[model samples]
Target: MALHPALTPVADLVGTWRGPGRGEYPTITSFTYTEEVTFTDVGKPFLTYLQRTWSPAGDPMHTETGFFRVAGGEAVEFVLAQPTGQTELAEGSLVTEPRGFATELHSRVVNAASAKIVDATIRRLRLDGDELTTEFAMAAVGLPMTHHLGSVLTRTA
Candidate 1:
């Protein structure tokens, strides 16, 4: 099938990207990982998005499969599901500048294992000719935490 019209603008992200990433909460840790994101269109209004994250230490931390849709001009919604017992229904609007595209996503993570919910806000920035960066601010387990998950990812494929 062909790509969705709304997702065509994000076609650049449909590949493998690698870089060092940091996760911060009460503590900070660094790791190297390769992120594989694929976008598929099924003749729908939205794009089917799948992301696999892997580290040198193991296979993959998580995989996200979802649909990307647009509304209110530049606003976007990402509904994702994971096999590790989690799902996120996030919504955000795009902030496009001369440099890149910035999306501020507000979501809630439902932990299917513990029946816990976490409120999260993520800012994902993608520069025109640079790597992608995502900063996450979350209130998980009744604790406020802010960190960088994918500090930067260089295109590897």
Candidate 2:
């Protein structure tokens, strides 16, 4: 099927990517995991996103599902939900580079009563050819915004 015109800017992300990633937070020990991320086009203006991570021993660590859309010009948005009882609305801009694109997103977080307290988050992602690099900062659980995770992944499908 032909790609939606609105999704042209992020067309490169419409595939499965897998690789290693490291995560850390002020409240927990640092650890490494294997991560897989997939972006699928459902014949709509937005792309469906799914991400999952597993520990080195293959235990499931984290997962999230979301929708990504280009909201005209360089503006983009991502609405996501996590099993941890948190939902996030992120808005950002996408800048086209010679190799690919770079995005900087800021998110407003809402947590369920039973969920951990998460106030806000910032994420930066750069896609160059088949490599995807990402960094995230978060404010939560009495901690101010601080680096939380980073990963470099390669297209797997």
Candidate 3:
């Protein structure tokens, strides 16, 4: 299918990426996981996003499904839902670079009554050639905003 014209700034992300990731936070011990993130275009104005992670022992760790949309000009929007009982609406700017593009998205979260408290989150995604680097920061569980996870994934599809 043809790429959406508005997605020109982020066309490079339409593929599957897999790599190892390190996760850390103030409330928990640091850990490492292997992650796979995929972006797909289905003849629409937005790209479908899916991410999953697994432990070294092959245990399922985390997963999120979302949609990525370019909201005119350099603005971008991301809406995602997690099984952990939180949904987020994140918005940010998309900047074009020599290699690809980078985005810094800040999210407003809605948590289910049974979910843990999550104050805020910032997600950063950078594309350089065939490599995509992802970082996540959050303010949650009575702690201030802090670095939570990071990974460098390579395009595989």
Candidate 4:
């Protein structure tokens, strides 16, 4: 099936990417570890996603996987699950302009440890060339959460 030209910008993201990243939360005494995210497009309207975080010592920390779909022209809905006995459903919108590809995604993670759920908003921007930058923020435990993660992935055959 041919993808609508309007969806090309989104379809161009159909591939696999890997990189290292860090995370921070007030609950932790210090920055614990890094992470890697894998995005796969199975020739569908949505992208299949998986993310894994590892301790600085190289031990596995946690993992999450889900599907991300676009709706109503700039809105996106994500359905995902975590190995820590939790699942998330988020809604947000995408904004693409002359500057770059920007996406604001809000997620509600259920069955968390400290709080009932986490409300996180993620933003990603495609920069000049193959570079991509992303920022993540959340509201949990009645406070605000923020972080960063991104990578420059070359198409692999």
TM-score of every candidate: 0.76, 0.98, 0.98, 0.72
TM-score (C-alpha, index-matched) for candidate 1 = 0.76
Residues 1-157, candidate 2: write the lDDT tens digits: 8889999888998999999999999799999999999999998999999999999999999999999999895998999999999999999999998888999999999999999999999988899999999888999998999999999999999
Poorest 10 consecutive residues by lDDT, candidate 2:
68-77
- Please provide, for model 1 over 59-123, each residue's C-alpha lDDT reduced to its tens digit, 9 standing for 90 to 100: 77767789877665588788888786678888888777565576877886777866545556564
Which 10 consecutive positions of candidate 3 have the poorest summed lDDT?
A: 1-10
Whole-model lDDT per candidate: 0.66, 0.93, 0.96, 0.61
Q: Between candidates 2 and 3, name the one with more favorable lDDT.
A: 3
In model 2, pairs of residues that clash are none
Model 4 steric clash total: 0
**Residue 19: error of model 3 in Å?**
0.3
Instruction: Summarize candidate 3's per-residue lDDT along 36-136 as a digit string, tens digits.
Output: 99999988889999999999999999999999999885999999999999999999999999999999999999999999999999999999999999999
| Model 4: residue 17 alpha-carbon error in angstroms | 1.9
Instruction: Kindly report which residue pairs in candidate 1 clash with one another.
Output: none
Worst 10 residues of 4 by lDDT: 148-157
- Off-target runs (Cα >4 Å) in candidate 3 are none
Q: Clashing residue pairs in candidate 4, if any?
A: none
**lDDT tens per residue, model 4, 39-96:** 6766667778876777778898778899878776687777888765567787777776
